[model samples]
Target: MPIEILMPALSPTMEEGTLAKWLVKEGDTVQSGDLLAEIETDKATMEFEAVDEGVIGKITVAEGTEGVKVNDVIAILLADGETADDIGGADAKPAPASSNAAPAEPSEATEPAAGYGRSGSAAQEDKPAAPAAGSKNGERIFASPLARRIAADKGLDLANITGSGPRGRIVKADVENVTAQPATAKAEAAAPAAKADAPKGSAMATGPSTDVILKTYEGRPFEEVKLDGMRKTVAARLTEAKQTVPHFYLRRDIQLDALMKFRSQLNTQLEARGVKLSVNDFIIKACALALQQVPEANAVWANDRTLRFEKSDVAVAVAIEGGLFTPVLKDAEMKSLSALSSEMKDLASRARDRKLAPHEYQGGSFAISNLGMFGIDNFDAIINPPHSAILAVGAGVKKPIVGKDGELSVGMVMSVTLSVDHRVIDGALGANLLAAIKDNLENPMTMLA
Candidate 1:
């Protein structure tokens, strides 16, 4: 039978994606792998593939459409022996009995939806078959409760084991997680078998619902905006994360005089190359390097287990229209200052323009949020799920310090607060990571080395 193509979630932070364009028109013959449509999620425009072999019987969603949910049917497919009338009888993901089922994808369509971070790595031979549970028989659970429902409606089972949520229960952690998994893709090929072996609520699917508060722009008496697509998703997930997780904060002050001096010297030569580096970029690299020394802090708290990562993908939070986003700087320790600065500019600029692609803002091992540019002294951050910790950075200030000889000295002061999930990250582990970051920042040269 002809299968339906969906409005794919292109990024993890996405709730609903815009039906940016349709690559094929109605009644067009399409193969299983053909490009069917392009979806605009919060991060970027992504191409959707035909999930099943079929003749395009009808297109339900038109191009330039907004707020299309991921799994709702976008088109009707015809089978080899079936005519257009038979398309309605073909077995669908849920049931084919409902003729009134909406032809368009689901309606969580907010602005743009983002997919989770994903890898093409092979699923562990030991951990296959998780997908079966998310089918008609079992339900899906992920790093967070929302990711769970999103995965379920999209027909993804947390059992297949490629996880983007904190413990990888297949939350809205990766856009690829929304796609038909690979035969050998971490969760796709083995989902059936994995479903039997999968544990219940392994993704920590249970959490308290969050409360949302409305706010207005600067200097306005009051501004309350309506919650739609991405805004609503952010409110819901962050609320659940805060209400359930036992979050604790650890604040530290680092001397940035050395780092500032270093930047001055670097910028002199860098200016000739048309590149300018910021303190935030240095912080990004420093945090990435610190993760190597403190992997325990770089883990997710999954159902009584801690999942640690080897490389640090730092999510740099950026402000966008009507909301905020964290566009990841993958593998920060591996990139040069110029490269990091250049990419940050690109991502931030695109975020402002609402043009980032899915891969840009998917899940990261850790995240850093800076408000120093706005002259904010300091603040604590909320824990982005699955990530054990988040670093909140504040403005650097001019301060005085006592030198070794007891003479007055000028130094640059910066404050950072690490928001930790006590379940996964211990106080000592978070301290160690924070100290490591301070050492790198105060020294400033070690990060480059």
Candidate 2:
């Protein structure tokens, strides 16, 4: 039987994508790891690869096809003895419903290309026997290569683990979620708990339908624009954030006279090396160090618990054409100002081009959304989930300030708002975190120390 090549989910959030281009045509011979197609997910355009050696028997979906759901059979590959005739009589299998399964692990026969990011490994048991390629009933065990390896290493039986992948094919997540305990016992415990914890009904109200909105604006001169994948994902995630996440805002103003002066001197000295730094770079350093100063604030909200981190991974919001990307800077506190600036530039450039990999923009304990460059005064940012808080920075302007001697003086001041997730951080902790950020920014030279 010809192997079905389903549309791969490039990112965890991707539900559907554009089949941008097909690299191989029908009747073309493809070896394992050969480039198959370019899939444009909600985040970026990534190349999909072949997992098995075969000849391309058929192409089900056309190039430039939009809204092609994940797990939909995009193409078919015929093994050594098979040909295109095999596809016609093949029994069509059902696709899974919006699967969250991970990609197969790389093997000796083929190495995964540079762009696709793999998910992290979970807890596992001691080594077990490798599962057979076929099940007891003689049906082929349809599991990802990575899933099979994990199952074997963890001493798990493929027959015991139910797959949540396309056509009941076992993927990485299905294998990782299983524990060392007996499958029956785990399933029994999980079923009742799942039933007890299930929400009674949909608490979220649906917005007015499209027809209703269009009818309401009947006879109006307007163009109905279509929402792209990036825009759609942004809308859904931000809507979920506002509705479900408990957010509290804390605002503060900091004098930036000393910082600006210090920055000028550093830029002048570093001119030969072409290492000029932006105020945003300093802000990144300040927030990263602040997370260290007030360690309690450096955390994320896991479903049932809080995940505290040892290093400060900061996500910086970069606005692009259709939407935005928050490329994360891992271990930001340890990086020098010049290094942070360079990395931010590269990330922002790639983000605008939609070339960032999943890992480049995915995880972070905190995020910074600065509209200061846009000349905005101040605004509260919606917390990007799992993140404990986000710092919203605004423009700096000259303001009158009373000195310790009671004399009025003009100083460059900037307004900032820290939007904290109450689940991971409290009011006092957020305040302290903001205070630390302010202290670092105001006495900018101390950042060097």
Can you tell me which runs of candidate 2 are displaced by over 4 Å?
A: 91-205
The Cα error of candidate 2 at residue 233, in Å, is 1.2
RMSD of 2: 10.2
Q: Tell me each candidate's RMSD, in Å, in order.
A: 12.2, 10.2
Best by TM-score: 2
Kindly list the per-residue Cα lDDT of model 2 for residues 194-304, writing each as its tens digit.
Answer: 553432222222567668888999999999788888887787678778888999999999999999999999999999999999999999999999999999999998888
What is candidate 1's lDDT per residue for 250-363, written digit by digit as tens? Answer: 999999988989999999988988988899989998998999878777777776677878778899999877677789888888899889899999999988877777677777
Clash-forming residue pairs, model 2:
128-155
Top candidate, metric lDDT: 2
TM-scores of the candidates in the order shown = 0.65, 0.77
187: Cα error in model 2, Å: 17
